[model samples]
Target: MTSMDLSFRRSNLLRNQPIGRGDADPLPLLLGQLLLRAGLPTTIERASSRPWASALFEGRRHSIRLHFAGEEPTTQRARFIAGLSEAEWRLPKYFVADITVDEEGSDSEGQWVQLSALTIRDW
Candidate 1:
């Protein structure tokens, strides 16, 4: 009878080494990449019905508020609102968000629009 040596298998060492690209802010770039997925392109209007995003629902229920800077265009704001509702459109995760476009006020810098976002996962 031949004795099998298990030392070789035990000696095999592997580690989960995550390579880093040293990106300062990769969210925006990643979002742009997600937008390029091949299919019916994510238009400004048909945002809710796509496989990317869910329509945001606001009511008296489980809710949380998040703040994100918006752009200077109404159309752009709308696009973000829709995208924020789905996990696919907004890379990373998904939640129902009430996106309110704030008026350019004393708190806002030049051309920097503020969007008050409230996210609710479920009723």
Candidate 2:
């Protein structure tokens, strides 16, 4: 009879290895483009994502917190918020089905906008 030895290794040793280049998720890039379209100096405070699926569709649901600094005039900020809700997104391999932007709150520092969106895979 022959015996075989199995060795174990630390998970962290493999964690830093690159699986592939350019295979990273494009969600961050898409979000950046959205902000750029708004033409506002925006800072992302927090973002969360979850996988979403239906009988025939699959995609992700994202909740993003954006901050517009006080430097921008109030009218411009209001226009940004209004336009963001109605703008059409042309993201690669993704289609934004629904989106909502709401004023979370504001202070002497900045204004906060909460954006919720549902993106469906196009491919």
Candidate 3:
């Protein structure tokens, strides 16, 4: 398990909000921490939202796409999901809007993993 720092600037929309105040609040950060605790290399690139037709579509998902130092991406994904589910049960308040995991191949060869989440609400 390796730790990678994913640094990115948050949009003004997110900066002006309080901690865990909205759907797009702190899920990404919490998800990143969960991934790290699960022994996976996870990072949050950025977060933003879109407003349309009196609805607010927020991208609260932590997009984690990376190559592990010495691990298969598929295995990493599985572990991450499992860890996340467990963490979710332990911490019910923290929600992951949508989590997408991709494993192109099997075993520890040519495996690619990606995850993202979305938080939607009516504005």
By TM-score, the best candidate is: 2
Give one digit per residue, the lDDT tens place, for model 1 in 1-123. 898766544323354332232112223433344334311223211111112224654221121222223343344334444544343334233343444444322223212223333333233
Each prediction's whole-model lDDT (CA): 0.33, 0.71, 0.45
* Residue 113, model 1: Cα distance from true site in angstroms: 0.9
State TM-scores per candidate. Answer: 0.24, 0.70, 0.41
Q: Please list all clashing residue pairs in model 2, or write none if there are none.
A: none
Tell me how candidate 3 scores on lDDT.
0.45
Worst 10 residues of 3 by lDDT: 45-54
lDDT of 2 by residue, 1-123 (tens): 997534434453477543223233446866887678555677788888777789999778888887777476355457667766568777777888888874477767777778888888786
CA deviation > 4 Å runs, candidate 1: 1-93, 105-109
Better of 1 and 3 by lDDT: 3
From the highest TM-score down, the ranking of the candidates is 2, 3, 1
- Worst ten-residue run, lDDT, model 1? 44-53
TM-score of 3: 0.41
Which pairs of residues have clashing backbones in candidate 3? Answer: 61-117
- What is the alpha-carbon lDDT of model 1 when measured against the actual structure? 0.33
